[model samples]
Target: MGEYKPPFTITNKILSYISSISEKIGRITAISNLETKPHLRRNNRIKSIHSSLKIEANSLTLGQVRDVINGKSVLGEQKEIQEVKNAYIAYEHLEEIDPYNIQHLKQFHGIMTRYLVEESGEFRSGEEGVFNGSQCIFMAPPARFVPQLMDELFSWMKESKDDVHPLILSSVFHYEFVFIHPFSDGNGRMARLWHTAILSKWKPIFEYIPIESQIEKFQDEYYRSISECHIAGESTIFIEFMLSQIDKILDDISVQINEKNEYLPEAVQKLLEVMEYDIPYTSNELMERLGLKAKEGFRRNYLHPAMEMKLIQMTIPDKPNSRNQRYLRC
Candidate 1:
């Protein structure tokens, strides 16, 4: 492990993805209202937790994950439900964790695997492997080598932090982390979390980008990228795969933001225009703001459609007809 650089090449295609992703991140973060938009941030964070857990065969649906987070009783396995809970708690502390510190990573893992794994915070004391059905796809380094390998990897990351682009830096760390397979049960989840954490440190908007959703959509390609890279003895392929995913996720967010009005009903679009993302408006208040005198028409053509499309969510979902109910743009 002497002077180890964790073997990865940056290609021109990777450069293109980085440029595009960086620009999108900058544009998104530059929006003044983003910091105050809880709905937007919450939606993305829930998707990330749900999708990452789903990739680990957690068997909980995205809606169920949201329900669990909201303290609603959901019918699911205890382990999967606990995974969602754990992930939510861990993600809430993203701003506090130091990505370059190995102890912080292990501490985060402890939080992530609490009540689930036998050795929550500790690296595997035995051999580990990546399995696909009954076949073994990759064998991790021996347990004795885990500490030194991880120490070297983290040292490299800290030393190179100022010199490398985070898109590449995080991607390399992800590939190397998986190859190390340090944890007994939560290796994949940790890899995804740390990858997001690293990017978020670079640009806070990344904490809300739902990169896990993109990874879950291309789970096969993710594993394929890892296997190909392992065979080639470098992370170049996986880095490219992840950069492409980030580029695509940015494009997806742009579509939902810019082109949603194209498919929305005219009434819904008009209603949304009258509302601010960070403000909650009661139906009567919204109607007054819209200069609509008829409650029935507004509810039928505007409110109902917006609610159906989830363009707006009721502040009191359980008691939608509550007098105190308010609607906020989602």
Candidate 2:
């Protein structure tokens, strides 16, 4: 087995920051589970935003991340659009599988890389390069080291018994794996997805935490952290950067939860509870579930009130009159 080395002083500073962030993650988890209509909506929107950001960040082709959030066909051609749609579907399905399972990881890779590239889920069998413009900046381990690195990662994840914090492990693993750049493409996105998977496995609040938004907010910092780690021969700076972002995200959610606790109405609150896990409601669906005779009445009395408070966002932003319009608890 290969022995892992501890990072030095600069790396220790990063780990210390991560420790602080991990402490707050517990608070964020508590706030997420609390009963509050406004906070629930805020949390849900954050989750949606983060998921969307993940898709944009992970895509091989470049486009505005906003285009993805607005549901525009930024990928252009039919084949490219189909590939992006497939990736979204696969990401949604990630909730159903265990991230710790190596099989599931490979499956995610398969779905993520399908049609985008020839290798897809398979690991690189030869040399790889990281480049900026015309210059190559760094090269990963030799081809022979690829399988062993993956094996060690899987084994560490499975056998870790020290109550090592999942978020910490996730940050560390994300940096290390991306550094390895095991696959031919999609390494950055895969690392983020895998981090979420690991966190969700540890605490379900991670399912709602939109870490990607924070990443997108500081994309340059994110890249810099990774590069710094590469140059310094330590994972600590990257870990600290990730943890600090998570801390801020959780803090934001906590404030939103507190505000929701103060002002959300009872009917709207109950609706939020009902739709906590499953969302995307139509007028008819709301009428059926709430046992109301008139769809308009239900909207005026229940849905509109929630919408006014921003507890629900319209699915059809442009065409409110469309029969296909749906409401999701955002």
- Residue 98, model 1: lDDT of 87
Error of 2 at 294 (Å): 5.1
- Model 2, 110-185: lDDT tens per residue? 8877788677788887788654334455787887798778877767766652445676678878887877888887
Q: Estimate each model's TM-score.
A: 0.83, 0.70
lDDT of 1 by residue, 1-330 (tens): 548788888899999999998888766555433465456678788999999998888898877898899899999899999999999999999988789999999999999999999989999999999754455669999999999999999999999999999999999999999999999989999999999999989987788889999999998889989999989999999999999999999877765444456577778867876775546789999999789999999999999989998889999999988999999888
Error at 145, model 2, angstroms? 2.6
- Prediction 1 global C-alpha lDDT: 0.88
After superposition, candidate 2 runs with Cα above 4 Å error? 5-25, 28-75, 95-103, 131-137, 159-163, 255-262, 268-291, 294-330
The deviation in Å at residue 6 for candidate 1 is: 0.6
How far does residue 296 in candidate 2 sit from its true spot (Å)?
Answer: 7.7
- Provide the clashing-pair count of each candidate structure: 0, 1
Write out the backbone clash pairs for model 2: 41-330
Worst lDDT run of 10 residues, candidate 1, spans 28-37
lDDT of each: 0.88, 0.67
